[model samples]
Target chain A: DAGVTQSPTHLIKTRGQQVTLRCSPKSGHDTVSWYQQALGQGPQFIFQYYEEEERQRGNFPDRFSGHQFPNYSSELNVNALLLGDSALYLCASSQTGTGLYNEQFFGPGTRLTVL
Target chain B: DQQVKQNSPSLSVQEGRISILNCDYTNSMFDYFLWYKKYPAEGPTFLISISSIKDKNEDGRFTVFLNKSAKHLSLHIVPSQPGDSAVYFCAASGAWGTDSWGKLQFGAGTQVVVTP
Candidate 1:
């Protein structure tokens, strides 16, 4: 079976511009989460979507938002992007029934480069 | 403050030897711990994990040991191969507060290189 998949392997944007990244969770999975990994740091949690509603969010600014469709696919939208927004956007999928013990499958990730 | 920390930035080991990567966390609420291996330009791949109730979990060549009293966890790889070279990240998930159970806190990661 195919694992989690993300669209637009890479993206380039200018300051004050907007960007949208897409992710399709692994088959049989229902929860989707997003993370941002900088140049030399580990990924920082952005937010998580479950039941088509945002369940939890990290400390990121309001400029970062996300949506989860009924099919369990997700989209991450960053508005008024800044230079610091440049990073690898990773999408991870898990099953809600497993709760905290579920192993999340991650996609190849979309590399966002803000110019 | 970093709730999860991987003090070692890199580690090198010979082929057929054992490689041990360490991780420490300060959050007692973090009951579930996981290790993820990431190659350059790719997302992390789940390796192994241990729950708070269990002190150890093993899967194939990977073994994870958890010390709840010390709030430390480690991933041990036996007979390391060159393909094992990558960045290993320690992640934890739990209901620390009102937060969702799916949220995870990750460490900076440790790079491991296995030489032939």
Candidate 2:
């Protein structure tokens, strides 16, 4: 079975522009979460989506938002991106109460580069 | 602020030796811990984990030891092989039933290099 998948392996945009990244969770999974990994740093939590509603969010600004579709796919949208927004966007999925300690499977991630 | 931290940015070890990576967290509410290994151009891969109740958890050559009182955990890879060369990340989550439990706080990661 295919694992979590993300679209647009890489993206480059200018400041004040908007960008949309897509993610498809692993089969049989329902929850989707997003993370941002900056250079030389670990992945930081962005937010999570469950039951088609946002379940939790991190310290990120309002410019970051996400949506979970009925099919368990997700999209992360960053409005008026800044150069600091350049980072690797990772998508993770977990089936509540199905895996070990809610182990999450992750996609390769979309590399976002803001110019 | 980063709740989880790996003080060591990188480590080098000889093959067939023991490798230990340390992680510390500032949040006491975290009960579940996990270690993930990542290679170039890939997402973090689950390695092993330990719950708060258990002080130790092992899988093959990989083992994790948790010290709740000290708020520290370490991942040990015995007889490390060349394939173990990669970046290892330590992550923690809040207790179940908490709103932030679904999101994991991760450390900056420790890069391990096994030299033959």
Report every candidate's CA lDDT. Answer: 0.92, 0.94
When superposed on Cα atoms, how far off is each prediction in RMSD? 1.3, 1.1
Instruction: Name the fnat for model 1.
Output: 0.68
Q: What would the DockQ be for model 1?
A: 0.66
- Residues A3-110 of candidate 2: C-alpha lDDT, one tens digit per residue: 999999999999999999999999999999999999899999999999999989999999999898999899999999999999999999999876446678889999
> Model 1, A1-115: lDDT tens per residue?
9999999999999999999999999999999999999987888889999999999898899999999999999999999999999999999999987554757889999999999
User: In model 1, which runs have C-alpha deviations exceeding 4 angstroms?
Assistant: B95-100
Taking all chains together, each candidate's TM-score versus the true structure is: 0.97, 0.98
lDDT of 1: 0.92
Instruction: Compose the digit string of candidate 1's lDDT tens values, residues B1-116.
Output: 68899999999999999999999999888878899999997889999888889999999999999999999999999979999999999998875343536778899999999999
Off by over 4 Å in 2: none
Local error of candidate 1 at residue B56 (angstroms): 0.6
Candidate whose TM-score is highest = 2
lDDT of 1 at A102: 56
Q: How is the predicted docking of candidate 2 categorized under the CAPRI scheme?
A: medium
